[model samples]
Target: MKLSFNIALRFLNSSKGQTFLIALGIAIGVSVQIFIGSLIQGLQIDLVDTTIGSQPQITITSTSDDKLIGDYESRLSDISSDYEGVKHVSPSADGPALVTSDEENYSILVRGLSFEAAEGIYKTKERLVEGSLPENKNEVLIGTTLKDESGIQIGDEVDVLTSSGENQALTVTGIFDFQVANLNSSWVLTTLETAQSMFSYDDRITGIEMQVEDVFLADTISSDIQADLPEDLLAENWKDQNASLLSGLNGQSVSSYMIQVFVMISVLLGIASVLAITVVQKSRQIGILKAMGIRDSAASLIFVFQGLMLGIAGAILGILLGLGLAYVFTRFALNPDGTPVVPLYINPGFIALSAGFAIVVSTLAALIPARKSSKLNPIEVIRNA
Candidate 1:
């Protein structure tokens, strides 16, 4: 085995330029694979973050009793104790309300929540453009779009008309920018008590909002939660709410796999052709080795060793190149605030998989050439020479 490896190394070194070129081709292919894989992963993460990073992965709401959930506190405790992925279970009371400012009325989604629980999912405090989360039932936090459209600001008192025909004056204590235009334009954040009082619900909440440790497992967790709850109570997950987004992500994955498969085929063909040419060029040498009593198995191993060497060397170079490309992109691709457009998180497992795939593909490409070399006739080759 050592002798076959040494011979393979010598043959490759003998044609240094050709060997380098073939390795370069492999490097380029592997580099593309790494970059594309990393890029796609980053994009998917960004998309998920934008969609649900500050939103509940699972939401529990009542199908009966006009959006009121009975014994929400007990239900929340049961869910926390029973569920595996449960991170934070926040109770919220939300309903449409008419907000009147200087004789102009705007319909908004008035959501009542506790700051501690709301912050866990929405990170509302972090996104506070001005002031802070409402401290009491009398104070409320309005979105930036609502502030701009209605000319409302902190310390301003606004009249809210609830669904039950009850009206109350609430003070805006802060303004937040959720970044989503619809949320910014329509959401009015208040306290659970305030929302219940306005909606005429005595100690009852509209629903329970929840965040999970694994966002992708929301569907399964939600179903389990639903099964554990009353028939009137239903659990909805992010996956169910964002079917279109999931479809798009699936399409992207399929396309990426297709591209990778084609790239591997191209790399395989390139290595195979080069090895075939090398076999023809080294026919006399192979015949001489065979005549010297080298087994066919050992002769075949020579080409296999060459393939492995090329794969290992090329994969190393490719990984370096891929990392460099990712770094360059992160540095150059920036937003107005100097943050990266898409964050690149290189997974070590993914890198290892890419390297392993390249190595295996290269080895397989050498099989045909190895078989031809093993079948070579020493007499015929010597006479032809």
Candidate 2:
């Protein structure tokens, strides 16, 4: 084995230009594959984050006519204890409300929540564009769109009429921008107690909102939660709610895989063709060695070892080049806000996979040349010469 490897190294060393060219080809192929794969992954992550990052991936709501869930505290506890993926769980009460300011009236979604618990999902505190989260009774946070449309601001009182025929004057303590136009325009966030009082629900909530550790796994978790719940309670997931978005994401992934596969095929064919040519170029040396009684098996191993060494060098170079390209792209591709339009999401596992994939493909590509070299006619070569 050592002898074959040494011979392989010597053969590659003898043709420095050829070796470098082959490695460069492999490097370019690997780098392109890595760049595309990383870009697609980052785009998918950003899309998912923008869609549901600060929202409930799963929700438990009642199907009864009143549309309110009683014993929500016990339900919250059960959900938290039963599922490890349930990262944040909060009870909420939401209903339609209208704000009458001057001669204009604006329709809004009045959601009552425990800010401390809701913080994990909504990130209301972090997303605050003004003032602070609602801390006092009748104090609430309005969305940016509402603030602009109604010309309302901190310290201003908003007179709200609820669907349940109750009226209250809410003090604006803060304003938040969820980045979703609808949410920004319509959400009037307040305390859970305030909502219950306004809606005349003694101790009940509209539903239980939850965020999971893995957003993709929400469907399975929601199904499991539904199976265990009573008939009147329904568990819903974001995947089910936004079917079109899920379909679009799936299509993107399929396209990305197809591109990667085609790239790999092209690289493999290049390596195989080069190695086959190498065999013909070194035929005389191989024939002499075989005539001297070096076994065909040993002869075959020479090309295999050469392939492996080339693969190692190419894989390392490719990884570095790919990483550099990704970094450069993110740095230059800016959004109006100075953030990368496509943020770099480096997955170490994926980088390792790409390197391993290139190495394996390269080694396989040398097999054709190795087989041909093993069958070289030693006697015929010398006689012809």
Candidate 3:
């Protein structure tokens, strides 16, 4: 093994330029894999965070009438208590309402929520960008999108009129930036008492927002909730509500994997081409080594070592460059509201996987040339030379 290493090192050092080129090819492949993988993962995280932050993990509602779930809170509690993975549950009432400002009027989804019950469950209050959450029955919290569209500022009074012809004046206590493109456009939040009062529906709720301990268990828990619910009520998980987003994320992940596979194949081809050329250039030397009683296996091992070295060098460089690029992207990109667009997260598992992939490709690339070099006839080569 030591003799093989020494010979491989001698060969590599003698052809420094070629060795560097081989390493660069491997590095480019590794860089593409790392950078693209990280970017896609980052986007997935952003989508999940944005969607989940604005919507509950699971929701329980009425299949018959929107008021059924709210009116049956006690029965809902009984069913929710039977589930082990439920983190918290809060009742909500939502309906389409007209919100009018001095400058403009817009239609929005008015959601009625309990301040105390929804604090931890929905994280409704934490996203407040301006003013405070509604403290009285006549106060309201508007989404940033609504605030922008209507040009309503904090402390302004907005008239909320229900579809049932009930009208009430609400003080704009707060404006919240949920960072959801769609939700921001049409959501108006208010205290449950205020919403029920405006809609003239006492003790009624539209749905129940449920937070789960394990996000991956959402479907299971949602199924259990549905089974336990009254026939008139329905249960839906976040995955169902955001099906398109989840599907798009899954597609992106698969695409990223496919890209990495292609990149590895390209790198493998490059390494193979370089090694084949090296074999031809050193045919005389290989013949001499064989004549000196070096085993065929030993000769093959030398080329394998060279390929491995090239792959390692390239992969290391690629990882560094890819990480640097990811950092740059995360640091400078901004959303419409001038906040950071996406969060960058890199897992150790991904790094290990990428590096292992590069090494495997390098080893495979060296196989054919190494085998051919090992089979050279020493006497015939010397005579031909």
Candidate 4:
């Protein structure tokens, strides 16, 4: 084995130009796989954070009616008591409404919440970019996007009309910049009492939002709540609410894997081509080794070792390059809303998988040439040389 490895090392050192080319090919392939994988993973994390940060991890709503607001507070309270993972539950009333200022009018979603109960979950007061959260029933907080479109500022008075035909003038106590495109553009926050009064639905709520102690257990807890709740109420996890987005992100991840596989195949083909050329070029050397009583298996091992060395070298270089590229991309890339994109985490599993893939491809690439070297007849090879 030592002899085989030494011979392999000698060949590699002797043919510096060829060894470098093959290693470079493998390095490029591995780097691309790593960089793309990181990109996909990063996007998936961002999508999940954006979705879950803005909305509840689980929502309990009425399935019988399209609108969420009604006299289900008693049922909600009951479910809240029964669920084990439920950390905090806040009942919300949501409906379409119009906000009008002297200069502009915009349609918006009005959500009513119990300020104290919601603070623990949504942290509404902390997220307020300007002014304070609503202190009285008449005050409201609006998203920054809503305020900008209406040309309104903190302390400005605006007329709001609910879908049920109730209208009231509200003082904007705060402007929140969530930095999320979907949330910022359409939501208006107000106290539960104020929302009920404006919508003329006192003692009713649209839905209940639950914060779970364990996010990973959300599916199980949501299922438990659904089974215990009335048939009319539906419990949904964050993934269920944003199925399309999650599915798309998953598809992107799968696509990244496919790209890595394709890269491996391409690199293997290049290695195979290089090995085949090396065999033809070293026919005389193989003839001399055979003449010196070297077995076919030993001769085969020599080339296999060479391929393994090239693969290992290339994979190491690729990992470094790929990680650097991913770092650069994450540092510079921006979301649609112009915020710095958070980096995608590169797990150890991915690195191991990439390395294993390179080794496998390298071994496979040497097989044909190894067989050719093993089959060379000393007499014919020496005469041809």
Candidate 5:
């Protein structure tokens, strides 16, 4: 083993330029893999954060037109204690209503929530643009777009007419912007009690909104929740509600993997071809070694050692190159306000996986050339020389 390693080192050192070029090729391939993988992962994270960061992963709601979940408090308690991965569960009641201001009248959805529980699902307190969350019954928080369209000021009282033909005067205590224009324009936030009263829910909630520790696991958890609940109650997850988004993310991941696979294949081919040519150029030296009684297995191992060295050295250089590229991207790719356009999070496991695959693939690429080295005819080579 020592003899094989020494011979491999000597060969690589002797053909310094060729070895360097082959190593450089491998390095470039690996660096690109790291960069592309990290870029896609970061983009997916950002997309998810924007779309559902403040939204619930799973929701329990009534399936019937009554729009009321019976014994919701007990159900919520059961889910909180029994389900794994369940984070925060918030009960909310909402319904369509006519919200009229002095200047305009618009149809909008009115949502009622408990302050602390609502914060868990929507981060409502953090997103408050004006005033605080609804502190008492009939005091509501309005969406910014709704406020602007209706020409309603913070202290204005709005008339809310429920579907049941009941009219109630509600105070606009605060304004919020959820970033989604549709949500901002058509949603009114109120207290759980007020919503139940407005919707005639009478001691019942329309649904339970819940966030989970792992968003991706929401679907499975939702299925489990549904099984535990009655037939009239249904559980839905964010993934179910956003199928198109999940499809796009999956497609992006597949394409990225394909690109990385092709690049790795190219790197493997380059290393294999270089090692093959090296064997041909050094046939005479190999024949001499065989004639001097160096075993075929040991001869084969020389090329294997070369592969190991190249894989290790190149992968290290590739990791460093990848890190530098990531830093450059994050530094320069910024929004108008100076925040990163796409956040870059480099996982150590991903780096390790790339390097490990490169080393294994590079070693495998040397097998054919290594076998050729082991099969050289000493006498024939000497005669040819």
Candidate 6:
């Protein structure tokens, strides 16, 4: 084995250009695989994060005509205890209200939440662009668009009118942008106590908002939660709410896999063709070694060792190149606010998989040449020469 390896090294070292060029080809192929796989995966992650990761994955709402989920604390307790996947549970009272501004009434959903609990899902603190969260009944937070349109300052008083003729004068304590235009223009936030009072729902909330560890498992979790819930209530998940988005995501994943597979096949074929030519080019050297009583197995082993060395060299180069390309993309592909258009999401496992796969393909590609090497007759080669 050692003799075979040494011979393989000498053969490769004899023709440095061929060795380097073959490895370079393999490296380029592997690099593309890593880059495209990582890029698509990153884009998918960003899409999912914006669509559902930042928001509630599961929700519990009432079927009753009043549209209120009663006994929510008990339900919250059950979910928090029974479901290990459940990350955050926030019971909220949400309904429509009008914000009167200069003879025009702007309609918005008044959402009441337990700030600390809701923070896990909404990340309210991070989204707050001004002032602070509402801490008092008289204080509230409005969306950025609402704040802009109404010209309402942090301390400005907001006149809120309910559909049922109940009116309340509240002060704007903060402003937030949820990143969705509809949410920014049509949502108002306040504490749970205040919303319940405003809606006159004693000890009851309209819905229970929840986030889970895995966004994709929301449907399963929600269905299981439904089975455990009272008949008067139902559990809904983000997946059911966004079917088209999920379909698009699955399609993207399929397309990415297809591209990677074709790249890998091309790489294997390139390595096989190059190594086959190497066998022919080194026929004289291999004939001399076989004439010196080297076994057929060892002759085959020589080409296998060359394949392994090439695979190792190419895989390492490819990994570094791929990572560099991804880094450059993130740094250069900026949005208007100087953020990367597609934020890089690096998975160490995926990178490792790509490298390992390239190496395996390189080794397998050498098998054809290895078989030919074993079958070579030293006597015939000497006679021809």
> Cα lDDT for residue 318, model 2?
90
Q: Give the TM-score of candidate 5.
A: 0.96
lDDT of 3 at 3: 77
Q: Report, for every candidate in turn, its global Cα lDDT versus the true structure.
A: 0.90, 0.91, 0.81, 0.83, 0.90, 0.90
Model 6 lDDT on a 0 to 1 scale: 0.90
For 1-385, candidate 6 gives per-residue lDDT tens digits of: 9999999999899999999998998789878888888899899999999888778999989898998888888878989999979999999999799998877789999999999999999999999999999988867898999878877789988799976779989889999999988898898999999999988988999999999998899999999999988788889999999999999999998999999889989988888899899988888888888899999999999889888899889999999899899999999999999999898878999999999998898899989999999999999877776
List model 2 lDDT by residue over 282-360, tens digit each. 8988999999999999999999998888888888999889889999999999999999999998988988898899899
Residue clash pairs of candidate 3: 70-205
For candidate 6, the per-residue lDDT at 210 reads 96
- Clashing residue pairs, candidate 5? none
- TM-scores of the models, in the order given: 0.97, 0.98, 0.82, 0.78, 0.96, 0.97
lDDT tens digits by residue: candidate 5, 19-108:
888888888888998988998899998999899988888988888889688788888789899999999999999899998877467999
* Runs of candidate 2 exceeding 4 Å displacement: none
**Model 4: per-residue Cα lDDT over 1-385, one tens digit each:** 8888999899999999999989989888988988887778777776676667545898887776555546666766876788787888889988798888875678888988988888767888778899998879879888888777778899888888888777889999998877775677788899998887887777788889978877657889999888877778788987666678767877897888889889899999899889988998888998999999999999999889988999999999888888988878876887787665766578778877887788778888988799989999999999988
Off by over 4 Å in 5: none
Q: Is candidate 1 or candidate 4 better by lDDT?
A: 1
lDDT, candidate 1, 206-320, per-residue tens:
8899999989999999988888787888899999989999999999889988898899889999999999899999999999999999999999999999999999988998899
Model 1 alpha-carbon drift over 4 Å, by segment:
none
Model 3 residue 92 lDDT score: 81
